[model samples]
Target: MGRPILGLRSTLKSLTRRDIKSYMSRRYSAESVFITATGNVNHTKLVRALSDSIGKIKRSGKAQVIKAPVATRSVKLVKRDLEQVHLCMGVPVPSMTDRKRFELYLINTMLGSGMSSKLFQEVREKRGLAYSVYSYLNLCKDAGSLVVYAGTSKESFGEVLTVVLNEFEKLATELTIEQLNHTKDQLKGGIVLALETTDARMMKIAKDEIYFGKSMPIKSLIKEIDRVKLEDVRKSIENYLSPDNITLAAIGGGMKKRDLPSVLK
Candidate 1:
């Protein structure tokens, strides 16, 4: 299991006032902060106001930066009393800085990012094996993962798993020009729509600053998406979607932990 983001209650209770103050001083330093304001905001006035308020903050010692744990391939199953079986399979991929990151994003969109994506169409619309199925990309500073999730009845678990795995395996060889273009268009559209909101734009700028140490223009990202070719997508699939590197987690009432491996196979 992963460590809770807010820490355990016992751990939180052990923290002293000095510890909290020290942690806040280290983590929320001026160097680590990025502020973005949208709309008709005056840059000069905003900076003056920010400087007046932020200048009072004292810098403590540098925060200790811990590396993310390396991901390994494994399957874990947790049985519960539930009506639907939920499963998630993940594969580690390159970090956000990698040039291949865009290709992975496109692959995720084509695979299961939307209603018209491969997983949704095949697993829910066509086969009726699952009510919900989608793929997502989790890109961090130093590591990333492409994950697929589905929920289905206990009886349909095997079929759903088989379909999901087959779809991933087939991505290594079977991408069409039409699929590539369509997914690109979809991604571009989503980006444009997302940036229409001031909050989204602020979030984008903050993330870009944190990750790239600079703001990346939306046009540049769109151009990169457009530049991804069919072969690039295929290569990303072959490299990141290897069967040997896959990890599976499942939660279901009727399913037994011992039956997971055979179902996955």
Candidate 2:
């Protein structure tokens, strides 16, 4: 696959973000074929042309990256229905080239990563507020996101938002070295434990190569984890732990626009 895919380049990479999205929107007009076939796509027309060119490379020159058009989601809740939202709040972080992917990782983990995380212990355990919660660090080819989420009863929606924001402020302010270290250890342990399987190792290597442009050695990766300092975690939290970077995508009971400030106060 690499040999066949080696010479490919994104013609759309040179275009402005708006132009590229517009081109993708027009090309794939109603089809999703182009983006899936080629991992790096730029337009709808390109997708159509690629689909038409499949098994006929000479007829199409070279295969291109898939870039689905930038447009609104196909399915949107009605304004009234939006009262129950699924907030997908996130902040952009270091480029894949920065080699500090782990920093973004720890931030995600310490925030609301699991049943034991800050958000869960405070919001879920103490208050028994939400039905479910999760934290995720979505690292992409060039960029990434750190997000926290929860689904709660509409009646407690305002307080849920409040708890989330207050927790965010605490993470930025009151986080102690011990708290940070525990998070780092958990983060490192999770990765190492995941690598216990051969298939997992192969998949991780493949993903590393695809997203980070190189297959990182497990040993060096572990060493990097061990080297993470208190300052490192703090720096990541300081830059990313902000409400402004959030993009709330809510879908569920009893939240209103007016309740947005449960945390601001």
Give the winner by TM-score: 1
User: Compared to the true structure, candidate 1 yields what TM-score?
Assistant: 0.92
- Give the alpha carbon lDDT tens digit for every residue of 145-220 in model 1: 9999999988887778778878987766788899799889999999999899888998998899888999999999
lDDT of 1: 0.86
Report clashes for each candidate as comma-separated counts.
0, 24
Query: What would the per-residue lDDT of candidate 2 be over residues 142-203, giving only the tens digit for each residue?
Result: 55667677777667766777788788878877878787778777987888898887677667
Q: State each model's CA lDDT, in order.
A: 0.86, 0.65
Tell how far residue 176 is off in model 2, in angstroms. Answer: 2.1
Name the 10 consecutive residues with the lowest summed lDDT in model 2.
69-78
Provide the TM-score for each candidate, comma-separated: 0.92, 0.68
